[model samples]
Target: MQRELIDGVPVLWAETPGPLEATLVFGCGVRDETFRTLGVTHLVEHLAMSTLPRLHFDHNASVDLALTQFTCTGRPEQVADFLERVCSALCALPLERIEREAGVLEAEGSGVADPTTAELLSIRYGTAGVGLASFGGPGPDRIPVEAVQDTVARFFHAQNAALVLTGAPPAGLRLPLPAGERPARATGQPVRQAGPAWQQAQVPGPGLALSCDLNDQAVFLAVQLLRQRLTEAVRHREGLTYDVGGDVVFVAPGRGERTICMEAREGQEQRVTELLWQEALRLATEEAPEAELAEEVEAAREVLLDPRAVEYELMEAAAELVLGDAPMRGRARLDLIEKLTPARLREAFAAALGSALLVVPCDIEVRPRRADGTELPQFSCGQGGELPTVGESSARP
Candidate 1:
C-alpha cells in the first residue's frame, strides 16, 4: 500500500496480484463535486491514452461529481509497464483548464429549424428535462458548445489529478517525480438544483415513466440485481420492452441514484414505462417475498461483497467513504449484509416508495413537425414555453 502525492493531492492506492485470476487492476484519485471535470478527465484519458504503447489491456477513466479516476486492467506480465506509462500520462495530459461562470444550460428556444444531424440531435435532447440544470449528464437538448470546451480545459490542468495502481507492485519500477508540488484542493460536494430536474418528459400518451434513486453501500449490488430482475421481467418474461434499464450513478459522499427507463415496442412505450414504474413502486412498497428477496440478497452479496476482500469491492467502499461518506468498507460491509434481515430491507423499500416524487415532466422529446416539413432547431429551452409553466394551469392540460 503506497499512497503518495503527485501534483499535491493525496491519492489512496494499493497493488496486489490476484493469484487466482492473474488480473492486474488500478484506479485514480478524486477532486470532489467536479462533475464537468469528470467528463473532462475522461476526455483527457481518451486523449492521452495514445501514450501507453506497452499497455495491452482494457483501459478507461471515470469521473463523477465527487472524484476523478483512471484505471487499466492488464495481464500480470504487462502490469509494471502499464503503471509506468500511466504515471507519465497523468502528469503530461494536456489540459487548458477553462474557468467560467456557470450558466443554466437552458436557452430561449428560438423557432429555428435544425439543419444538421448534430443540430437535430441538439434539439431532440433540448426538450428532455436535461440542460445545464445542475443534475448533470448531457441533457436531452442543445447544450452550449462552450460548456463542452470549458470542461475539457479543466480536465487538463495539473492541480486536479490522482492516480492509483493495483495488482503487483513492479519491483524495479521507476516513477518520475516533479519538483514543483501540486497544491491541495478543497473537495466540495455538488448540490442538486433547487427542485428536481430529473423527471420523465411526457411524450405520446400511455408511455413509460420511471425514476429510482438509492444511496447505500449496496448500490452496485442493487443495480446488478435490479437490472437482472428487470431484464428478466421486461425482456424475457413478458417481453414488454425491447429496451429497459436505468443508470446507477456512483457519486461520492454517500450519494448515488439508480434510474430505470423503458420504451415499449411500437406502441408499447407507455405500457413499458408504466410497468417499469411499478417495479420502482414495488421495490419500495412490497416486502421481499421469500424467494425473490433471498435471490436478490444473495446477488447483492456477491456483487457488493465480492470474495476478493480488498479489490474492486474495497475500492468502491473507499470511494463511498471518501467520495460519498457513507456505506460499509473492507470487511465491515460484508458482515452487515449477512446480518441484514429480509424485514429490514422491506421496510427500507417501503419508506423510499412513499417519498415525494422529485421531477415529473411533460412534453418529452416529441418529434413535433412543422408545416414546411421542417424540424425545430435545438435551442436549450428554459422552464416555461409558449404555453404557461407546469403548475400555472390545471386548466391547460
Candidate 2:
C-alpha cells in the first residue's frame, strides 16, 4: 500500500509476491548539500555501515556529492532494532568536531586511499562549464573531511529523510516524525519522459582514453545499444572480463544530461581506445539485426529482475522519480530499447556526436587526433588531482 506523513517525510512500503531473503535495505538520499556536510554524511555512513563480517549479511552506506545515502540489511526480526539504531544515529551524530571523535575523524580523513575505477572516471568527468579545468565536482579527492562537517551543519534535515521497509517489518515500526501533516506530493513521485543535455566524459586511467558521449533521447538509446554490443564483444565474446555496461541517463531535473560506463578486463587502459570508440560509433552509425537486440533486451530484463533478491526492495522505478521525476518503466524504457532500430540508432548517434562529452576511465592522456592521425595537444588539465579530499580510509573503523 501507500502511506505518507511523519511530519513531512514520505514513506513507501510495498508487499511483493516473492520469497524475500528476510533482509531489508533502506536507502536515504539528498542532493548537493555543502561540500563539508556532504563529507560528514560520508563519515556518518561509515560509522553505521556494519554487518558483523562473519554473519555475511549486508549493511553499508554511501554519500555522493549530489546525494547522501544509507542502506541497512538484516533479518526481519531486526527491523525494529535496525530502525531504532538508524534513527538514533540520525538524531545523535554530532557534526561538531567533538574532542573524542577528532582523533577518529582526523585519522580517517587524513589517510589517502587508491581511487576505485569509478573514482578514476569521476576525476575525468568533473570538468568546468567553459570546457576547461576541473568543475569542482565529485572526483577521487574532491570532497574533504571539513566539507563533510560543513554540509551537515547546513542541510541535514530530518524531514528530508525516508524509511523504506520491504521484507516483514516490525509491527508499528515507524520513523519518529513530528506532528504537522505531510504534503500530498510526499507519498509517490511523478515521472517525466526526457531531459535536456549534451556532453561526453573522459576518465583518466592507464591505457586508452575512455569517453562517454551524451545527447537527446535518440543518442541516449544509442549509448545503451553500444554498451550492450561492447559487452557482447569484449566480455562474453572474448571473455576479457565478466561484465561490461554503460548508462545514458536523460536527466530532466532542471534539464541535465549524464552518461556512465563500465568495461571488461579494464578496457579503459588498452590501446584499443580506437576500437571502443569505433564500436560506439558503430552503434550510432551502423545497424544490428533484430535478433541481437532481442537477446540484449532479454539480458536487460534479467538485470531488472535481480533486485527481487533483496528483501528490502526499492523499485528502481521509484528512485528515478525521487531524483528526476522520470518514468522509464512500462512501455517507456521498453520502447527506448526497442526503438533503437539500427537505422534510426545511427541517426541518433550522428546528431549526438556533435556536442558529446567524452569520459574515458584510464590513465591515458587524451590527444586530439584528426581522422588523418594528426595529433592535437590544445587541451590541458587546468589542475591535477582536482578532487576535494574527505578522509583517510580505515577499513571502516
Which one is best on lDDT? Answer: 2
Provide the clash count, candidate 2.
48
Q: List the candidate 2 regions with Cα displacement exceeding 4 Å.
A: 17-38, 47-58, 74-77, 94-150, 167-169, 177-221, 235-270, 304-324, 359-378, 381-397
Quote model 1's TM-score. 0.56
Reference-based lDDT, each prediction = 0.41, 0.42
The residue-by-residue lDDT of candidate 2 on 257-367, one tens digit each, is 334344435643443344455575566556767776667666655654565533223444234433434434433555566556667767766555433334444355445
lDDT, residue 8, model 2: 46
| Per-residue lDDT of model 1, residues 49-166, tens digit only | 5566645466654443344445566564455466456557655643332222112112311211111211211222232212111333443132344544443344333333434455
